[model samples]
Target: MTDASGRIALLRATIVVVAAGGLRALTYRAVAAEAGVSHGLVRHHFGTRDQLVAEAMEFAIDESLRGSNMLEQGLTASEFAAGIESLADRESALQSFQYELLLESRRRPELTPLAERHYGAYREAIERQLGRLGVADPALVDLIWFALDGLVFTQLVAPADPAPALARIRSLVESAAA
Candidate 1:
């Protein structure tokens, strides 16, 4: 593999390890083993476990957002809701990994800023989506985003079918515009 491909592969492996094991259990050797590369490769790429964990966390957030279509434009309500379900289905450990990092931040103050910044992306995306739907009130974005978040969180723990709740949210947004 080329340098870029190799780097991507390594990063992907790091994300899997971090997602499966959490930051507390992460080690360079473990990442390397998971990636099928040498431990020195992981060390050379990331320099330290802290750096690896940080990058992995960022990667997870970005991947989750991308997979969920949170950054896409002109999404219908069904599309948006389907995106949420797809994320939960495809990236099963993603939410758990995110929550793990969030809780870990309490003990590792240095991680707090990273966690906040990562979540800010989600909020910004929700705000943009609301804006696209012609919802003028900023507070509405918060309420809708939190409600959607609650739906996603509950789905993660209970594994429910999301179509009904999603349709209701869609109706709510439509009614708000009407």
Candidate 2:
């Protein structure tokens, strides 16, 4: 793999490693084994473990955004969180990786800013979609983000059908718009 692709691969491997075993399991050797490369390759790309975590978190955020409709403009209530279950199911590890980062930030002061920034980006995307639905209330937007966040987390821990809960959220948004 080229430098860019190799770096991306390592980042993905990092996500998988952290997702499965949390921050304690994030070692260069583990990531290298996951990516089928040498530990030196992981070290060469990210000089420190902190750098690896930060970069991997960024890559995970990009993946989450690409898989979500939160950033899309002009989406209807019915379209909100459509296929969210499948997306969550398919990207379970990716979602878990982000959650791990969120939890780790509480323990590591340095990671707090990065976690907040990345999480704010998701909240903002959801806010934009809410705006398109004619619900511009900041509190309501925050509530929606929380609900979506909760749903995603619940699904991660114990797989459940999210359709009904999402339907309720959609109805609430539609009523708020009305």
Q: How well is each residue in 1-178 modelled by candidate 1, as lDDT tens digits? A: 8887777777788767766777756787887898899999988988888787787778778888887777999877555545544355677677667777887998999999878977787889877776776767778677767776677677667878878877776666667655
After superposing all C-alphas onto the true structure, candidate 1 shows an RMSD in angstroms of 2.2
Clashes of 1: 0
How badly does each model clash, as a count of residue pairs? 0, 0
Estimate TM-scores for all models.
0.86, 0.90
The lDDT, on a scale of 0 to 1, for candidate 2 is: 0.84
Candidate 1's C-alpha runs over 4 A off are: 76-86
Taking the tens digit of each residue's C-alpha lDDT, what string does model 2 give over 1-178? 7999999999999999999999999999999999999999999999999999989888888888778876666777767745333346769888899999999899899999778877797888877877887778899888877887888888898878888888777777778767
Q: What are the clashing pairs of model 2?
A: none
Return the top candidate by lDDT. Answer: 2
Predict model 1's lDDT versus the native: 0.74
In terms of TM-score, the best-performing candidate is: 2
